[model samples]
Target: MLLLLIPGVGLAIAVGILFGWRWVFAPILGWAMLTWLLGSLRALGKDAKPPGAPADDVVATPVGTDQRTLFWCEECGTEVLLLVRGTNRAPSHCGQRMHERTEILN
Candidate 1:
């Protein structure tokens, strides 16, 4: 949002310079004043906590012994135990050889 305002102010200044009008400074000045006002308001509002939002709501669940699980890698057919802090959606290792079962020929 702040990045977009810079180009607008620059264009306004350039046009103002080209036209020899002092009004160009008005836009740039207005933008700066508005930016400062909005920024201060935003800062002031930051301390007002929203309802029903717990302070620790963003915390991640700790990986525990109960979370020990197994996953199979489709790419290499390898079965691996899920590690703590491991990827939750997929197998941990890449290019692992998956276990295969077959009947032996007599």
Candidate 2:
């Protein structure tokens, strides 16, 4: 889709030069800018939330020695062993925060 912009710009330049219609570039450039802005917004939205994942506001507290806590990512089968962290925020993977799973080792 971005490759199409090159031809659009070239065509705009050609029209402006041949017919002295300089105003044609305005709409073309505006379209390009709008496309870029929308694309960036979509990227941010995707990075903000992954499918079937809860919000990031939930904080996980540290567990005892007998209990183990795992931060798991649903998007990609990734597991992280959270141990002795000062922060309450959960670990993140694949742009989203991992879900917490507690297990008893005893």
Candidate 3:
């Protein structure tokens, strides 16, 4: 993120210089370069982690009809079907009621 600021500040400084506001450009350019360097160093020091590591915080729930399931609108408590997985929580279609059902999986 800080790395991205460097070019922005540089551009601003260049523009300021062209517009005769050279004094303000120096500080902006300096800060931008400093932040960019720090960000680059931090990124370089970090190591990439492998996929599906134990430290990863993903909770996998089995998807099927076998287990006892409760489907409801998390927002309104309306009955609804667990149609798909969402990034945070399951979303309901309409009616504000959770549609819950149970069936045996083959």
Report residue 49 deviation for candidate 1 (angstroms): 2.5
Which digits, one per residue and each the tens of the lDDT, describe model 2 over residues 29-88?
898999999999998896465778765454454555678888899999899987655456
Per-model TM against the reference: 0.32, 0.41, 0.27
Give the lDDT of residue 63 in candidate 1. Answer: 51
**Local distance difference test values of all predictions, in order:** 0.59, 0.78, 0.61
Give a tens-digit lDDT track for model 3, residues 4-103: 9899778777877787666676776898999999999887666444577556445445665465445766666566444443433334456343455655
Model 1, span 1-106: residue lDDT tens: 9999999778877887888656776676898999999999998787556888655323343554234445666776666543442222343357443432322223
For candidate 2, the TM-score is 0.41
**Runs in model 1 lying further than 4 Å from the true structure:** 1-14, 17-20, 50-106
Clashing pairs for predicted structure model 3, backbone only: 72-98, 78-96, 78-97, 78-98, 79-97, 79-98, 79-99, 80-98, 80-99
Enumerate clash totals for all models, in the order shown.
2, 0, 9
* Candidate 3 Cα outliers beyond 4 Å, as residue runs: 1-20, 48-106
lDDT minimum window of 10 residues, candidate 2: 55-64
